[model samples]
Target: MTTTLQINGRPVAVTAEDDTPLLWVLRGELRMNGTKFGCGKALCGACTVMLDGEAVRSCATPLAAVQGRAVSTIEGVKGPEIDALRRAWTELDVVQCGYCQSGQLMSACALLRHTPKPSDADIDAAMSGNICRCGTYPRIRAAIHLAAGDDRR
Candidate 1:
């Protein structure tokens, strides 16, 4: 099946099965490798991407679900919030191994989009699903606050 999708504000056509995971389609078909494959199951947030402005697990999301929907991968994430996130991630040194940072950033973007000035509890709740083996949660939280212009330590 040829699934037409809106990716990063561009229309892209992908030839894949309806059941094909969006991760594979993005990585294999579209050659967008920013979204990583972690647990394969939805438990890991390493394959997180934005589906119609909401953070979703691309590894588990079917291609059919994304057809005609707007998808934003790490490669396509833009805007001031994302720029602020990138700066914060760099300044705070949030990435250790860096395998999970893309998903972390995506999730953070979604959180900030919804709650521009999130509390500690809000950050905790929003980031609970994204697990960083390097345990950089403190830096991640701080970076999110910095991106939001909170900068409260």
Candidate 2:
């Protein structure tokens, strides 16, 4: 079947079964490989993408479920928030193997976008679902603070 979904600020038409995971259409069909496949389950946030501005695991989210919805991948995070986050990620040295950093930044960007000045507990709650095998939790927290412009400001 054919499906239409908004992605990365652009409308994309895809021909796939309704049950086809959005991750496949993203990486396979659309050729957007930023979203990685880790567990192929929602347990891993490697496939996290913003659906209507909220992070959703694209691995488990079927294409049909996202039809007509705006999906923002790491590739689409533009302007100030992402700029700050990306800079903070570098400044804080948040990436290890670099596999999980995309998802981490996506979640962090969302948190900073909404909360702006999230506390430690708020940062923990927002980032709890995303797991980094490199154990970059401390750096992640530091990066969040740096991105929020809360560090040394």
Candidate 2 lDDT tens digits, 57-92: 889999888988889998887768889989988987
The TM-score values for the models, in the order shown, are: 0.98, 0.95
Model 1 CA deviation exceeding 4 Å by range: none
Error of 1 at 128 (Å): 0.9
Q: Which digits, one per residue and each the tens of the lDDT, describe model 1 over residues 1-153?
A: 887999999999889999999999999998999899999998879999999999999999999999888999999889888999999999988999999999999999999999999999999998888989999999999999999999785
- Go through the candidates in order and give each one's C-alpha lDDT: 0.93, 0.87
> What are the per-model C-alpha RMSD values against the true structure?
0.7, 1.4
Clashing residue pairs in candidate 2 (N, C-alpha, C atoms within 3 angstroms): none
